[model samples]
Target: MHPPGADTVLVRHGDLNTKSNTVKRYMEGLLAENLEAILADRSVPGEVERRWSRPLVHTTEDAVEDATAAAADTFGVVSASPCLTTSTEKDRILEVLAETARARYDGGSFAVDARRADKSLPYDSDDLAREGGAAIWEAVADEFEPEVDLDDPDLTFGVEVREDVAFVYLEKRAGPGGLPLGAQEPVIAMVSGGIDSPVAAYEAMKRGSPIVPVYVDLGPFGGIDHEARAMETVRVLSGYAPNFDMEVYRVPGGETISVLVEEMEEGRMLSMRRFFYRAAEVLAERVDAHGIVTGEAVGQKSSQTVQNLGVTSRATRLPIHRPLLTRDKADIVEQAREIGTFTESTIDAGCNRVAPDRAETNARLEPLLAAEPDDLFERAEEAARNAKLVEP
Candidate 1:
């Protein structure tokens, strides 16, 4: 527990606990730092400390809600609870439990969900639950008949006893469960003004990879409004990792699209994808990123077919991570909504102006390679060199 009268938020780790001790310690340190960064960014007065593998955020009563919300949004946290803490003495524990229940419960079925993290305590989890439930019932019995419904209670008070302290909380805010940001090397994410690509970048962020967003500006094909939407989507993503000042790399891609349009008709989409991948590779090299992330899903578009995806992947040696590779469109849209990018992505970004009437779904490697401009790699390099940074 933190200082008396201060609010304490208990943050539960997600997959971080599954790692080996060394790795877990490293990740836990990163998580705490990230949480501190979040609090600082929000101007919330707080201090974060690791307690028995969980991060505990201590803040003044005025900032507790904001602190709890920040903890819930942070990556690697499965859940966060703003709790009332007291000494682990049996009488004090029951007193605080009853007080919390009285404030939250109003004439409804209730349950005491207690857990003992400190084995040294004389009472077990069941004993605490039973005693706490009795106290709560007695405190509220005068107002209304207190019914104990263990399976589905109208209000459930959670009690967690650890070492010398007990915490009682009413609600658990769900977090985006995954590894902490910066746990893995950054990825050059090929984001666009569409729904799926932004979601893909978010998924990459969720997977512990801080992202350097690369938006290809198809001058005539995708208008200035398209670039605006893409940048806006990136801005929304920036909210996720407030500690990092994310910049969007704007790669000029009109020349490459024009070249594809002039040289190849049927495989234009495939060749264009190859150009995007190559451009990403150049950016990845410059930024020392480990991989490239995209929104391509199997059979989602002509260029995203299994065979065509393979054909396009040959353009870059770095790994291509398509987070939405197997996800359905509906699910992707739902996630976009959840992450606060759906509306901006829905705004009209003109369709690909160079798309052929019928793109080759099952493109082969050799012929597609042959159709590509001899200076394709050079063009990609040029695009990467000329990329303008857009701060979000």
Candidate 2:
């Protein structure tokens, strides 16, 4: 139990499989704003703080109790309770209000904001509001003396239920969450004109790491196909963040790798990665970004093995931040779902087109560096310098 000034209980809406980082980010974003509110008043002390996710994790009764405990824990909290009313169904909302209202003592007024995210739900929005409000009144009337009017009730509660989740909170403060702002300096993404890199760029932006997306338009990977994908992805991402910028680096590496593949000993994956990082570094230095961010997940495939990661990492002095590094396929899929990137990336093109069927997983650094064709790095640098600067 917490002694509370302002208790906040975060609720997990559904089985969306949202990452802890994203949730944490959203909560922080909310708290930062709410804390400022408390601070401005100078009446609430110790500031607004959040407890761990509770409502969604616990059963209905337990979630309520947990919320109460968190609120109570705050230093200056007068009293706290997890709001017990939230639902996409108006009937459910009314049912919850009628059911939970019995717990309310005298001197408390309640409000219902019937928020509807799913238009397909059975009832109209207004119907939900009226029924829900009526339910609370009925519950109060049945359980205790009817306070003539709710205008001056001792406590005020609110309910917000939408598609996939509901939030019942006494207070709605802003969240500290935005993209993890300023974690990494701006970097130019490989922007494969494919799904992964664009999605990766979006993830990078959310973290507050500025991006200079670098799309390598080889002109041979089906002309308008690559360019169209790159342009469209940047457009969607820019909608989320207006101030984004991009640079299209045209590397003829796709064709070059095809020719080189014949000369290598089944290590084409490593060779391709080498070219990618090298090209990326040239752009990174040009833009002054500290490191490159990629969508690579470790061991999801052969090319992501420990040895492959090590070899690819060697191509640049700047650190590579693989946000998806340890994520499983399911986790990555879920993230893509949240950002609207999954479908787009998948439909654009496949990554393994040029990769070997069974690329070397345990690439030795000495042989990997020593094996490749000459002037690959030099060609990459020149190509990066000429990549297009697309506005996000």
Candidate 3:
């Protein structure tokens, strides 16, 4: 068994920022108070390396072993191993092969999985695979003992080097990298036919919280056809969250919205959204959902403005989850793409189609609340009561 406090790092292919963020969120959710201690005074700093897309970061095998141990204690960590990635510096590709050999012979048997994004890498994938195999054999030499087998090793070394950093990590640790679990027991998401909401749902699911997707269909804005498209979008979302169930909340908001608009100004549209959230809260309680989720990204739109989100949030007594609240638009899109919801989200159009140009961002709560008519609250309650829930 590997000694305690072994420093192991994870090297995954693709975007480093996402991997880092995912790790941080998972750690925070799982470790809770301990996470603050881990980050505030990261005794395991050098234990985790960010090398673009590559799996291995240390130039020496000893360093890899040390990092592996420290990573194991980062909290919420099940297993920790080091990985080395190489998408750049095609010339040094053989070195990665050599390092893998060193790691294997040092202890476990390992296998190599190939990903060739940079066609210009010194050797084509097949050539590299063969060369890597040869290098492993050469490094092991006659020192190979009966106890260690080349073909079936315990460790699975991975390499993904994209852009500038050549990330290196062993397969032992794997990833605590999924969306967080149990931050909120259950929540609702105002999943529209858009990228943000799907990403939001995904984040909530990562937290291990059950999600109830609610879509509002302002018929004239986009009727049953749009509603059907939203349902199709749910089908796509299901792929990422196979174990989770999605419930579609369909609201025929045309008549209600028109009446609300005539009585209240454009700013009141946000208040109207709050009513919908309250409706979701009621449904959530019915289904034993502990909280609500929404695709509200900070500074993404008028309704997503701090004030608007706050106002809408007040309608719900349960916790409201905003997974995308602090993320950038580009980052959110990338996550949507990765989760396979990008294509479907882009195809669905909803209320934003006819949304007023001047949607408020930094709205003052007192003013907006004071401006809302009393009947508006009654209408919201009624609409929420009359809302329909579809299960998929």
Candidate 4:
């Protein structure tokens, strides 16, 4: 029903139907601002204009492809479709429909769905659908089959006749629906270049929290390739937020680990993890972020055991959000793949070292308390301040 090349992209609110009219309009604007921010980053030319009170972004044909893909990832967007903007005249509509059909109609079974929003039009919705379907069939029947199925067809063409202009579309792509990025609260995501952490960062982003990544440099345990991997993972996460570039804080993790090794003969792992939490808190304060996000799944690692997790929690005052706390590794792996981090996560970089023997699975708070080092929080703050900004 639409022209061959799509010039307009449709963006729908994630949960507009659940909101009141006023809230719906606000959500629409919020989605637009976020998407506009996305396009602005690319320097792509376009305007997000509403059509018939619906969010339909208008972009030049040259930029439509990039805009469509970016719009699909922006939070708060439910579905996006590339559409042709045309006049409401019947002849004009049929002419473009026929031309598009001749170019793309594969002589296959297809159906037309038409809605006349401009009630001023004489014809009803069903009449326009039947008429448009018949026109497409007549125009392309010479080269292809023209079987029309009202129920289920190989292809479904759409036409919406609004007061000012009509829109035609062939496909609708799914978007990650939630509040827009920065809508909730900002969080510092502790990324380890492993599978679970970046995925946890993604979950926070999906819930509308902008992410500031903090990568702890464990020194000789992880080499240059290890740092590169961590940066790459942050870059991967940045793809989700086109409008905002995610920053990585390369905290001097070696200092904390070295201190734990020198000061604590027992519960060193737990002490090291507590250092991680303290680093997260420092980074969050520096960036004005409200909390910390981690991919620490329960029982997944010795440091992640319930008791050990509790011991680590005491290190930070800010709220710690463990998005993958209860999620299974299989589920996390599937999500990592979905978010394009699975390949990078699987790379066996030298940074991920083997654990020492007697890895404390049930790190007790009492032991950790006894082995605590002096200037622990002060060293953590210093490490945060000395962190270098790394880019992929």
- In terms of TM-score, which candidate is stronger, 2 or 4? 4
At residue 376, candidate 3 shows an lDDT of 59
Over 90-197, each residue of candidate 1 has an lDDT whose tens digit, in order, gives: 889898877765676777788888989889888899999999999999888888899999999887888888887788888788998898999999999988899999
For candidate 3, the C-alpha RMSD (Å) to the true structure equals: 14.3
Q: What TM-score against the true fold does each predicted structure earn?
A: 0.95, 0.57, 0.57, 0.83
Per-residue lDDT over 174-257 for candidate 4, one digit per residue giving the tens place of the 0 to 100 score: 788777776677898988778888899998998889998988888777667777777888888887676675878889877667
Tens-place lDDT per residue, model 2, 29-127, is 443343334233333333333433332212234333443443332212223334443446556666665655555534345565555656777876577
TM-score of 3: 0.57
TM-score (C-alpha) between model 4 and the true structure: 0.83
How many pairs collide in each candidate, listed in order?
0, 29, 55, 3
| Residue 138, model 3, lDDT | 71
In what order do the candidates fall by lDDT, top score first? 1, 4, 3, 2
lDDT scores of the candidates, listed in order: 0.86, 0.56, 0.59, 0.78
- Window of ten residues with lowest summed lDDT in model 1: 1-10
TM-score, structure 1 vs. true = 0.95
**Candidate 2 global CA lDDT score:** 0.56
TM-score of 2: 0.57
Query: Residues 1-392, candidate 3, lDDT per residue (tens digit)?
Result: 22222233553322223546766544343433332233334333352333333233232344555455433433233444555444466546667666556654564455655455666555565765566556666766666631334477575444444545444444555333443344347677777677788778777765556577777767577676766766766876554344345667665567666655666666666876776677677667667877778887777787877777877777768888787889999998997776677876776466665566567677777787777665655665566667787864
Cα RMSDs, all models: 2.3, 14.4, 14.3, 3.5
